[model samples]
Target: IVSDSSVLLCVCISLCLAWLHGDPRKVLHPTDSYGRFCGQKGTPNAKKPILFYFNILKCANPAVLINLQCPTTQMCVLKCPDRFATYTDMQLQHKLSKSYWEYYRQFCKPGFNDPNKGDFHIFRPNLLMCVCVCVCVCVCVCVCVCVCVCVSYRGLLISLVVSLVFILLLRFTARLLLWFTIIAVIFLLAYGMWYCSMELSQLRETPGSDVAIVDVGLHTDLQVYLQLRQTWIIFLVSLGLTEVSILVMLIFLRRRVQVAIALLREASRAMSYIMSTLFYPVVTFFLLAVCISYWAVTAVFLASSNEAVYKHTFLVNTFFSLCQTFNRTNISKTASCLGSQCTFAFYGGETPYHRYLFILQLFNLLVFLWLVNFSLALEQCTLAGAFASYYWAKRKPQDIPPCPLFSSFSRAIRYHTGSLAFGALILSVVQLVRIILEYLDQKLRGSNNMVSRFILCCLKCCFWCLERFIRYMNRNAYIMVAIYGKNFCTSAQEAFFLLMRNVVRVAVLDRVTDFLLFLGKVLIAGGVGIVAFFFFTRKIPVIQEEVPTLNNYWVPLLTVVAGSYLIAHGFFSVYAMCVDTLFLCFCDDLERNDGGSEKPFLMSPELHRILGKSSHSRISPLQILLVWDKCLPSSNSKMLQVRIKEPKTTEEMCHPSNMSVKILSHSGHSISRGNKSNTTTPQVYLLTSHPGSVLRFSKKDLQSTAHLIFQTHVHTKTA
Candidate 1:
């Protein structure tokens, strides 16, 4: 039942190799150019956790383009340099004061005592000013604790409550909630436009604020852009366009939105019955975390496999590999001028194993992507199966199976693993190509060849769209696979056609539902963000004392906001899947059954009513006679009076061309025709309402099945 046992085996083998060869320390700790991991315990550089570049400007050397590393001397340091002082300046000051030498020694390599030994003495001012900020252990632990407290109380707790309430609201008041969310989003955007306009108007009156952002160029402090009038204008225009777009969509697709809301209501009902599905995202999150951890560890090990190799660069453009151990005496030989030193170049080797590390890392990436996608596919399939049970059941909760989520999950893991892996593999391949294209784009960013850049950009965009389409197709295919237990390719084909057959509904209903759900997420995130901002900023008077004092409160505020959005998304994702499954099932129901008792619709009665459909298979004889009397002439109606008589057996009465009547038995079987009777007695009974019969008769005469009616004419009463 494992869909692709071979693929699973390959995954296992790849992970095993990765675990055997990978060392995660390379990623967790910074590494010096000397190939030693900084901050690692039980090492010489254990006390020196920070890696420092001797000449930061030399990092801009053209060799960086080829080697992907700065071509400069790097060393481990205990702390960053707080003050800027050139080696030459420090050397002269050292003679006047011992403090200068003590301070300068921290920047020098280990065991270097005499500064006069080197031939090069000149040092650039930029060489020593580059500093890397390092947080102390205590501070880091404190921040971690604070972040945990904030996320647990402000983020997780609120998000969980909000998400549950939102889902429940959707079940009973889906239309109202969806419309409210849509309106709120529009108003929020409108408010943003107004605010931006106000800011722009005020900035126009302020001198020096009229400068264009382009003239100012880029700034490290983003607040500088706010001072420019053009920035606010751009924001106002962007918000205005967004507002208009949403309004236009709402106006044009109002009916479709209503349908989508109805579908959401159905989905909510499904989720209400299968409450276990709301927690399935936790399982998916755990699986994804495992995959990401494995990939990171393997990549680190593969990268660290290369030992430190040093390259000695002379100030005059000559380069040599420092293959042998050398000391200050060797430094003098290389230092014909300033900037000459033995620098750690790149991590690599001539061995066959080291040569293939790139391939191994790529392999690691591919497996990671495959596993991530597989986990998502498995979730989709499991949720689909659970909701599918809800859709197919005739009775609401009584007919639905118990523990549907568990059964569906078991089925997905036991039988559809291979199929899930197959689908994930196809997507993984496309994603890997997109990643490669992105990498190439980044590499070509500095190139003068515009054609190559354009080509890479096109490839990137094409692959992006391709990934989106594939993801959509894969989701629907997994749903089909869950319902029918078909192979990946077969299910994909079937789902594709099913969607194509109802392309209009697919476009209008499904997308509108998604849009509404997205708005819900944005609303939750934005509302929570506002509350967090107030709490973090101590703007809420009641909670001011409870708020922790932090150097930057935005950190925790952003954490809460992002956490809320993710939580909301996870909960709403279940809702979205439910809607999609029900929609697909609804379409299938419409196609396979004609709303007749023989093949009644499996959809809920509410859905049937909303769609103006019924399952009745036939019209009753009494109702038929009433219609006949009304439509026919009065003389014929008086002579041909219909009366009821108890019958011993089911029978059909027909007067060849004049009239035809059939009686259906309790077992849904049609009886043979009886001889044309001259007696005026008539047996009129409802076929569908009879005990032991599941059939229901419609009042309409348009049924494709047998009907009860009388052909009326004046000649019938002449006798």
Candidate 2:
């Protein structure tokens, strides 16, 4: 039951302590044998950055592994030796000229100028070969990352086009396209199972291909396992099971899927009005990126704050003294021997702050989760407010306010920050508990007790479900906060009961919509992945010249595939939020407004048609046809009936500014007449408040009022 303010205070304190005690330089720079940071400003070894090892071959000694430190001297040097020169050769050349000694002395210990003590030392190439190998590997990886990042933009662009097209198709042909997507996925899985079966059959005919996967164990090369028949059999079984499950679900839930598709189409229509909502995910992404960057830096600095531990001269003397006192025979011959020492072994300290550093790291993770969830909550509330405006509007776009997205964003930031933060804090606590449980599970992975493992597994599953339930509840609570401007607890209670009231719809239609959206994302990612695979593998002759060559083509191919999925997910998240918001609004509309004349449903005509709820329930068919009885000339004398409740007063009828109407033709085409000069068909004059009072407008006046309702000839009915 941690409050938002308490969470904020804890985060501030953790960040403050981390910054005050942590030294990022300790993580960045290597340390010398003396434990001083290399290249640190104003330090003794400020000019020398790279750590050099003396007799680097001795690092292979078994004692190095036991002690977790190299068993040789290490020095901070400005640069590696440019050429190979053994100490013996340097010593031989030192008698003739001091130049070789001058150049080679940089690699030796600080005041050890006597060359004869460096007996049997070869100074094997300054250890640059090993350093170069590591540097080359790092450079290659960085280059690959850069190339992948640059190439990923193409996938992102394609995903943008594909997602936009998908949304548009959903708006126009939701049922058809959704059914197509589902069937395509099922067929694709079936094809995969068939392919795996074929591969398994072929492998059965080959010699030595029947080896069990267990016999090969775990090999670094995956091709070894792929060559075995067991791998194909596993793939075949997995695909077969998946295809069967999907087919069964589709068969049983076909009706519910139609309802979900209707909801998706409505969401798409809402998005069509507020296209700006599609780009709001970019703002969420930027905020999340900032939170992630800050958390990563704080974690790194806090982890590097421990004091550097090294093997010092005092420790070496203490060890020798202990040995002399206990062993009692090593002092006489070993008195004049120069004992070896190690450089930095590890990072740790006996200080109380260092001892409690793990607690600080945990605090950091909690704050990160809180901030990330808060960002997500803000996005949800803002989008909910925007779509709620769309749903509640009496008329479609004309009654809808201008810049609804911006207005909703402003409202969310101005008033609901605390509510969002509170919701985020609740979710963050559950997520933190789940993370801790996962960590414990990983730590106890090797334990032999079946009871402990089972208990841990059950705890993990319970917490995982709890986390998911909290997330779902928090999402709906944010929507309620957007609509009602209530506190987190009240909104959450109301949202929970509202959902419980319609649990069947929530379980069936809502989940079906989610599954469809997930399928769309997978299709987009897989389609783009297939295209990228062909291009990268040079399977496409046209793009072979454009593709960049790499040692492993799959690296960039996988990067493109993953990036496309994320981009598609970002786009699809907006649609998901819209659907959820509209569903909640629909439920609220049904519960509160019963489509009576006084409490008409605010949902659109299509929703009413799909859900079979008419807003003109209280006002029966004849009551809506209130007609004026005056007859006009022979050329145009059409009786006009306005589908509105009978007015009690004359002013209410004459000046009906609050009335909303849809004008339509006999053929069901919406019409708004503009000019009298182009009156080839027919025209209806404006009626005054009195039953027989008529007011005729000039052609110019009709043209001016034409912009108000820009359709063709039609009857009038209040929507």
lDDT of 2 at 286: 98
CA displacement after TM-score superposition, residue 502 of candidate 2 (Å)? 0.5
lDDT of each: 0.72, 0.72
**Residue ranges of candidate 2 with Cα displaced over 4 Å:** 1-11, 32-34, 38-132, 197-229, 309-346, 612-719
Q: How many angstroms is residue 552 displaced in model 2 relative to the true structure, after the best TM-score fit?
A: 2.5
Residue 448 in candidate 1, Cα distance off native in Å: 2.7
Over the stretch 488-592, how does candidate 2's per-residue lDDT look in tens digits?
A: 899999999999987877888778889999889888887888788788788998778988766666667778889889888998999999999998998898788
Q: How close is candidate 1 to the true structure, as a TM-score?
A: 0.77
Q: Whose TM-score is greatest here?
A: 1
- Residue 2 of model 1: what lDDT? 36
Candidate 1 clashing pairs, residues 3+ apart or interchain: 3-418, 4-418, 595-615
TM-score of each: 0.77, 0.71
Q: How many residue pairs clash in each candidate?
A: 3, 4
Candidate 1 segments whose C-alpha is farther than 4 A from its true place: 1-8, 22-31, 36-50, 55-71, 77-80, 91-121, 125-132, 135-152, 202-208, 211-231, 310-344, 537-542, 609-719
Please list all clashing residue pairs in model 2, or write none if there are none. Answer: 671-711, 671-712, 672-711, 672-712
Model 1 C-alpha lDDT versus the unseen true structure: 0.72
